[model samples]
Target: MAVPGCAGTPPQGPAPRGPRRVPVSLWAVPPVAALALAFLYPLALVVQQSFTPDEGGTSLAPYTEVFASESFRSALTTTVWLALGSTTGCLVLGFVLALVIAFVPFPGARAVARFIDVFLSFPSFLITLALLFVYGTVGMANGVWTGVTGASDGPFHFLTTPWGVLLAEITYFTPFVMRPLLAAFSQLDTAQLEVASSLGARPARIVRRVILPEALPALAAGGSLVLVMCLNEFGIVLFTGAKGVTTLPMLVYSKAILESDYPAACVVAVVNIVISVGLYGLYRVVSRRAGA
Candidate 1:
């Protein structure tokens, strides 16, 4: 045994500590559990319901029935077309608006951009209803035109057509595109643009070369978001009263609420969710690549 106070006793470095273990995985458990409770369980239920028809254990009968139905096919086709058209329209119009607000030196460009942001707070159905006020047969356009021109009809009857649904979706979703695009434009190296301008690159060519390439990632994100939303948009198409604009979401609503076909509705809902999730994944991949 060593003496307590003798200088001959070797100074002991801290008694060897047991290897420190970082419980890094403990941090992940809460989020993983939350994700399972929030997403996985609900999705499993939806998938199970989609497979069940007539209270049976499991079958693909619901999917088969939905695929065989003419209305289902028509609704899916219409939804795809409308989603594509609306996303493209939003990309074009939103890019132009964002460019003007970002690069163009206007007095109130920032103010206008902020004003456009207010649209995001408004419910989508409101935009459709507002369009009705402007373009409905007995609404403002018709009322004013008929009164002024002494004509029996109004100039705008497109409200009940596919054009109306497309327009409403674009109008509602363009700000989404604009918000991301303005962020993208804000980060762009204006020095590159200035150099292109000095080299006599025309506006359109400069946009095609320098601007569009840089903007593509933001465009992908915005377009994916808009496309997914438009794919599931019910209020805009329904409120517009567009006969040709029934989307998959509208089909799900009608099948469940009007026709009481819960299994078919679940099948359609599952498809819509799959598409939205897949597009969201693509957006993530594009974002990562752009960052790299």
Candidate 2:
């Protein structure tokens, strides 16, 4: 017999079993399998093609050829420079824009921010084309500059030049950098900012000590995204940068289309994928550290 208030002992010979196993639904399996096949299979094919030998069996000849070519070397260098320049420019401009939108008191600031969002939604190639209308040799800004200075030509040459491509990229991607940073800034604790201010921290000091650290993760993530976008950019470069600039993407296009060298194109594409993946990994590590 059990004591008072004690629960009665169970009379079962076996313990109660857990819930029955539920099989994954057929609907879910199809979508998952479709995604794997559609994206992963093509990517695997590209990687395999990159390794296929020009002469016969699997070899590193494609990669070796890419690295050995002077054109490839120049293209790689130009790609790196363009990516770095556009990324840095976007970061600087976007950070400043985000700060103004988030903290500063100004008329129509909300409207301006909304407009930026709208602008970001527009296609990047369209922005590049619009820039041609404003800064190209026959564009309005150049025309005005030429008229004002009585110069033989426009002060700026944005058509088919590296600078043109860089400028176009920065304009297009600045919003990419801005949106994440603005979100981060908006999420910051106002109480902490007030506390810092009450402790006699100057505006600059408070920003440096309190704000930048909190925003670093967003900045890093956005910058990495911009870098990746810039790395794979082909449309704008093809239009406004055909003169002297030769990026990896452009090389891949040229090889595939003009030379009909599918293997070489695959090789260039594989290199791009590796570089982008490596950079994204680095960004993730850095962002995690910053958050910590």
Candidate 3:
């Protein structure tokens, strides 16, 4: 004696299970394995080579010799100072230019802002080359000076000096700072600027109080990126023909290619990688905190 509805329904089995699905994390394995093989493996080789000596045993002798060398010390010092100087210059110059492009309403301002993106794609060596044309020994500046003053040699011989490298780095990397700044600035409230202006705040005061606070994160990120890039820069130094400017990367090139000192090259490369990775890690932490 089954009830009309309750007993009419037979027992229902469990809902149909779909085909076994892979865990989401498992999908990441292929890419991670590929990365390990492609990048991590080579980096490990370099690290291993850095520890290896010409005598063919794993030891720190190569590092000892390389670090003790005068060239390594000079290159390390030059690399640090140049990277710091270029980063400072880029931050200052980029901030000012970005401010003008973002706030000062002028004709072609948008065009100029857009041009920064294109500027970033231009190779670093191109900027060095361009600077050479304008400031090289017989370039425009020297040519004009020579033609006007009738001097045998122009006064612009600094093109192959450290200062020239600094200038080229600033010129090439400034746009990197500016691009992030512009993005940050775009999100800034126009109303605040207007209110500040109406409340009798001077331009400089408004910038200092209002604009700068909002821009600090972007500035920090941009500056960090420029710092790392400057640290690793080889093309600009090489193209500038700044024989005097032997940075870490340039030292690596000379050691590996010219001297055939693979162990020494690896040692310099490891140092550079450590610095770059440490800075990058710091940047990530700072950025995360800033965002929070």
Cα-based lDDT at residue 50, candidate 1 = 98
lDDT for every model?
0.90, 0.88, 0.95
Candidate 2 residue runs with Cα over 4 Å from true position: 1-28, 53-57, 149-152, 289-292
TM-score comparison, 2 vs 3, better candidate: 3
TM-score, model 2 to reference: 0.85
Residues 1-292 of candidate 1 have per-residue lDDT tens digits of 8896787897767787798887998989999999999999998998889999977888999999999999899988998999999999999999998888988898988789888888789999999999999999789989999999999998898989999888899999999999989888989999999999999999999999999998887888898889988888888988999876678999999999999998999999998998888988887787787682
RMSD of each: 3.4, 5.3, 2.5
Q: Per-residue lDDT for 74-156 in model 3, tens only?
A: 99999999999999999999999999999999999999998998898999889899999999987999999989999888999
Compute each candidate's TM-score over C-alphas: 0.87, 0.85, 0.93
Question: What range of 10 consecutive residues in model 3 has the weakest lDDT sum?
Answer: 1-10
Candidate topping lDDT: 3
lDDT of 2 by residue, 1-292 (tens): 8665567865547778999876868559888899889998999999888888667689888888878989888999999999999999999999988988988899998898888889877887898889888988788998898789998788777567888899989989999999888889989999998999999999889889998988887888889899999999998897675597999999999988999887788999989999999998887787677663
- How many pairs of residues collide in each model? 0, 0, 0
TM-score top scorer: 3
